[model samples]
Target: MSDQLLQLLFTGLTLGSIYSLIALALVTTFKVTGILNLAQGEFVAIGALLAISLYATGIPMFAAFILAIILVAIMGGCLERAAIHPARRASGLTLIIITLGLSISLRGLALLIWGTDTYSLPAFSQGGPLIIGGAVLNPQSFWILGLAVITLSVLYAFLGLTYAGKAVKAAVINRTAARLVGINPNTISFWAFVGSGALGAAAGIFIAPVTMSTYDMGFMLAIKGFVAAVIGGLNNIGGAVLGGLLLGVLESYSAGLISSGLKDGLAIIILLVVLMVKPHGILGLLGERKI
Candidate 1:
């Protein structure tokens, strides 16, 4: 259709890709530990802020990004070992409260250090937009999309092929049995936390240019991601990605057709509709409903 329509669609897809990455990271942690980790948004914020600060301190950009991911991963592992494992037997409500507490604590910590200022990094590429026929696309958008695809591909390979990945999957299926088979399910849980944190941080780093970074950004982003996960079917990682993309596109189109002010509320409306109709989500077909 028109260039404006194509531009809106592309923008929606790119933003949706960011949401998908965050959702998948949340799913990875949930599958292994059964904790939704509401602190995920904080993890993304922490990664972006830390990496940006590091780069500001004269560290190379690539090195700063790598270190940010690792640091976030470490934080994830530590949180699991210190906060999650201790209350492993607690009721689901208790566990959720604990994660919420962690989210609050992390946000406070970030604000303490970062001083509540908004920040964003320069795009990895400094060149002009790539124009195609009627529409212009940013190279940064491609970078974000490419990273999402690579992350999913690598995650699939880890969960489906490698021995460590298989062990993690087995742990998810049957923790006791996995332990009996010489797989340390607890260790796998820790790894899941690390992986999830790293992925979340990477999303934060890449998308910082598009969205202003604030201590509270994580909480907001996490809420949208939670809706996406619920709509996609929490247990299905693939569905998480699809649901995120769908939500993003819906929001984008709604903004184009309606009002920008209603875009955020529209996500909630879509979530309500999905829950009312299918509560379990698109991938709920797998088995054992937890959504």
Candidate 2:
């Protein structure tokens, strides 16, 4: 491939990794709780801001990143318990509205804490771009890609191999049955929120170097990630990954060959088209599915 094409492809993959992580967070939470979390993006913003703050306070960057993830994960669990658990028996629409409110509140809180200023994080590695196969790749791109792979792999193992993971899956598939089988859906939902928060935080920290961090960035990322999740089939983890990568590539190509302004618009168009033609998503199953 030509250098320009290669560059676009690499950049697209890197961008896709971020989207995939966000989509994964959404899907995981939805699977367990049956509610789409509007505040998921705020978790990402919190992660980035907290990591920067901690790092600036004389903590090592890696330690700061880890601490931010843990803090965000705890916050997610607390939010679930304090705000969502009370309304767990409410209608799905009601729950969604609550999450939207939570999103707005979180944004305002972030603004109060960090103001409107945008901040940048230094890349995990300090270096220039690496040229391979005629493509100039950012050093941080590898970190993003590697972390994405590792995150997905760990998730797969958790869902496919562990007992707790199986219980969570069972709860998603049939809550009543899972309850009869001695699994507490509430516990599963709490853990799902924690896991999603951790994923969102990690994605934010990793992408901060490329995208920068700001209080308002969460909503955009959430929208894009939601598009990816819908395209891939919200209940299917693998589908979320595929959708994110596809969306990323589409956006990257549009920005490179067409116009940067059109990239987001194009993604929304694709999302609309997908919903019209294949409402269940690319990998979503036919017929009624629980998750």
TM-score of each: 0.92, 0.95
Query: Candidate 2's error at 238, in angstroms?
Result: 0.6
In model 2, which residue pairs have backbone atoms overlapping below 3 Å?
none
> What number of backbone clashes does candidate 1 have, counting pairs of residues 3 or more apart or in separate chains?
0
For candidate 1, give the lDDT of residue 187: 83
Compared with the true structure, model 1 gives a TM-score of: 0.92
lDDT of 2 at 247: 91
Cα lDDT for residue 257, model 2? Answer: 84
| Alpha-carbon shift of residue 214 in model 2 (angstroms) | 0.2
lDDT of 1 by residue, 1-291 (tens): 587678778778888888888888787778777888899999989999998998899988999999999999899889989998889888888988999999999999999999889988888889999887688888888888888788778877988899888887776666677788898767887898888789889889988877888888887678778778887877767788888888888888889877899888887887788889888786666654432
Error of 1 at 90 (Å): 1.2
